[model samples]
Target chain A: MNKSIGFLGPKGTFSHEAVEGYRSGQNKAYELKEYHSIKDVLCALKDGEVDEAIVPIENSLEGAVNVTLDVLAKEEDMFIVDEFIIPVNLNLVAKQGTKAEDIKVLMSHPQPLGQCRNYLNTNFPGVVQLEENSTSKAAQKVVDGDGTCAAITSKIAAKIYGLEVLETNIQDNENNHTRFVIIARSLKAKTGADKTSIVFSTDNKPGSLYRVLDIFSLWDINMTRIESRPSKSALGQYIFFVDIDGHIEDPDVHDALTMVKRKTSFYKFLGSYPAFAGKI
Target chain B: MNKSIGFLGPKGTFSHEAVEGYRSGQNKAYELKEYHSIKDVLCALKDGEVDEAIVPIENSLEGAVNVTLDVLAKEEDMFIVDEFIIPVNLNLVAKQGTKAEDIKVLMSHPQPLGQCRNYLNTNFPGVVQLEENSTSKAAQKVVDGDGTCAAITSKIAAKIYGLEVLETNIQDNENNHTRFVIIARSLKAKTGADKTSIVFSTDNKPGSLYRVLDIFSLWDINMTRIESRPSKSALGQYIFFVDIDGHIEDPDVHDALTMVKRKTSFYKFLGSYPAFAGKI
Candidate 1:
């Protein structure tokens, strides 16, 4: 039976591309499904409408995608079972024969517009920018609208929407990449090279967080990343999302988290899964 | 002589309101100027065009404003001198005589749209949502266009744009607030009740960040908040922004920072300023 994988999409988004790339890596058959929003994808996973959901967790340029982080924090049923990194190469796509200079209005989702800020400022100095609901919608609008409009979207979108790429890698930074996480209802069996993600909030004390970090240090487990999101209960209170470079099934990791868990009022084990590095 | 303050605006933005609130608190007469973007506001400060720039640093619901954090990280000449907390009360403002049931579309900046998601979803499930460049722009568009549209903006914006407040405090969370920071070319003289903000990065070795936090614990300094933004140099690399309770001139804070400065590859003392607490 083919497994069902859900991702944020209108068929040509970066999330859709990441899902396709993940499907190819598994060497297993899967039925691809797309949701209109990040929340929709997670809700689909929770409601069993899909077996798994792949969503962008962080971007090198944009930092964390808050909606995904907040949803993962709130939805106790979902677990991150895998990770993928895709180099974000934004392209300036337009209808065929449309010259870059002739483009009076540029369009994209707010994020791409930001990532490509330097490029846009330098090239299209006085061009009007219009925000679309999604990058795919931006690409669609360029094709459906007049010749004097262009979109900053994916090359995949250019192909899917039958548009021509007027420019490639239009993003300001070459290192721009997005980290996507594969979420599922169950934890995967530990692969030797894996990472674990956990969310917890420390007690309202000065040294509470330092004490937690001390446990990781004592166990010699390397923490890959740490991000603080508001607890929403009050100002200055935060829930920390920590990624460590070992599976929970590992004895050292288990010992570290056990002690760390004891120190926090809220502790959630978000699962250990194979970690992906390098560009797609 | 009148001092000048810069803020993000098309006029009637939350940033504009924040500047007004800050001015009243200071009990001083100053000329207020509006800029097109956060960068413009900072640039105005750096160029000596404005005495100071006040911009939103973070939101209770939406994490850190990356552009503001990144700008602070990159611009060594600018410093955060003070902070203001403003409760974000999003209002559904429309042209006069527009009925809630007759509204076919809602408009706002993406941030407010997300903040008001639950309210929008429940009340106008089928209504079309539009994104404007700013919340103030959304209000202006509603007044300039058809009556069957509304905007999620501040009451100040509705009043300024000559729109009617169809619904008040329409945001999903009552506790939603934005933390705005006053940025200037020089740090403020330390107040007794003050907070210090600093940004730093540790060596890539394991336990490096833990060691830095250990120093804070050793000094008994209370860390009010901590945030990690990608250094933009590489994947998995991060620059940490930390807020601690105490003026930098405080002996304990100075001692801790002195030791911290020695340990990090990069350290920036953002500034010491009187911290604001309680609601505006």
Candidate 2:
């Protein structure tokens, strides 16, 4: 039997697009499964229902997808095996015979609505904006609702729902993109160009986090990103998430992470994966 | 003439409660105004429509409130003059005659829905969950709908909407709290116990952020929190938000900030304000 992969989907979402892109780039064909939510996809992978799972980690316009980050940090044995970046191109989609001027209500997932804030404010200032669980769901709602309803969703979603594309590229920033990561129960073999992601919490003292960063600095490792999330233990306490260049197999990267593990009160090695190489 | 304050409100949301707490602690009574959104409240402060505005900056369980951070980063002349922390107490409320078992649909803002995830899953596994703009809005929706609808909202919202409490303290985490910041045109006077928040972007090079944090380490200042948001210009580029102990009036903080401004390509001084004193 071919290996199976899980993704958050109803067939027309960004995660589905990412899975298609991932499949096109791979040598072997894999069985694909669609889960309802990010957590369901990840949990399916953890429970051995699928060989791998793909979920979005961050978006240029919206910042980190907190649920993805939270799950990765909280779950054990979940490792990132690959990454892909997809440009987010939002469109005003509606039922057949509907024009842009006919849109009395706009609907989408909150993130897309926010990304297209400027466009919506200028084009349909008084239209009611509603939130759906996903962009695809928004498109589905438009299909089921009156012709006056429109959805801000991907081109694929509009196509799948047989909706007219009233307008395209409606996001405020043309450079908008989302980064998705493929996760599995075990680590992937390190490619020459790879990134290691980790989450850790330092002691409640002056310069504790600075010292952890100092290890990366001292080892001359280049960190691509850093973010902090509340630890949930208290208001002031936080857990730091950092992504650095180089694979764990590299001597310096290995040494730096080993030191980081020793220095922090809590540590979790998320994964070492081949970094997304394409430009936004 | 009395000064006026602005908040994101329908009179029963958490921001409304924060403003009420702030007003009671103030020396003089201020006229209160309710805005439909966080951005509107902050923009009103910048445009001189209100003397001050209060908005939630971070939550213990859900993490940083991105809209508040984005507005503070994008807008000029907004300063943090005060801070308040509110314990999040989620309740299941419905019409007077509604019973707990009668709730066919659960409604709330996304944050509250997330905070009460475990509670809802265990108690109302098959119930439909809906999202509203605010917890108060969810309460209002329940009142406007059939008795089978229930809202996961604050006590204030239940009282204002004249709903009966089906259950109380439904959030998974008892320690969940949200931190709200009061923004004004100018900085507040330095209290001995204070915090200065600043946002900056470091050069896209190895150890650039480390060197900036090194200054805080060198000055013996404690950083209470640090978070990064995408620059939106490109992937892997970020701007950081940091809160540190001490007022900007202190020699160490002033010198550290001056150096930070000189080191980074972009810098913004959010403000110096007395830190919230109460324990969570």
> Highest DockQ among the candidates is held by which one?
2
Q: Candidate 1 chain B: worst 10 consecutive residues by lDDT?
A: B125-134
Pairs clashing within candidate 2: none
What fraction of the native alpha-carbon contacts across the interface, defined at 8 angstroms, is recovered by model 2?
Answer: 0.65
Specify the CAPRI tier of model 1. Answer: medium
lDDT on C-alpha atoms for all candidate structures = 0.88, 0.89
Question: Model 2, B92: alpha-carbon shift in Å?
Answer: 1.7
lDDT by residue (tens digit), candidate 1, A186-253: 99998899999999999988889889999999999999999999887766789999999999989999
Worst 10 residues of 1 chain A by lDDT: A125-134
lDDT accuracy of residue B73 in candidate 1 = 90
lDDT of 2 by residue, A116-182 (tens): 8778777887566766667888888898997889998889999899999988898999989999999
Clashing pairs in 1: none
lDDT of 1 by residue, B51-138 (tens): 9999888888777888899999988878889899888889999999988998987888777887887888789975767767678888
TM-score of chain B taken alone, every candidate: 0.94, 0.96
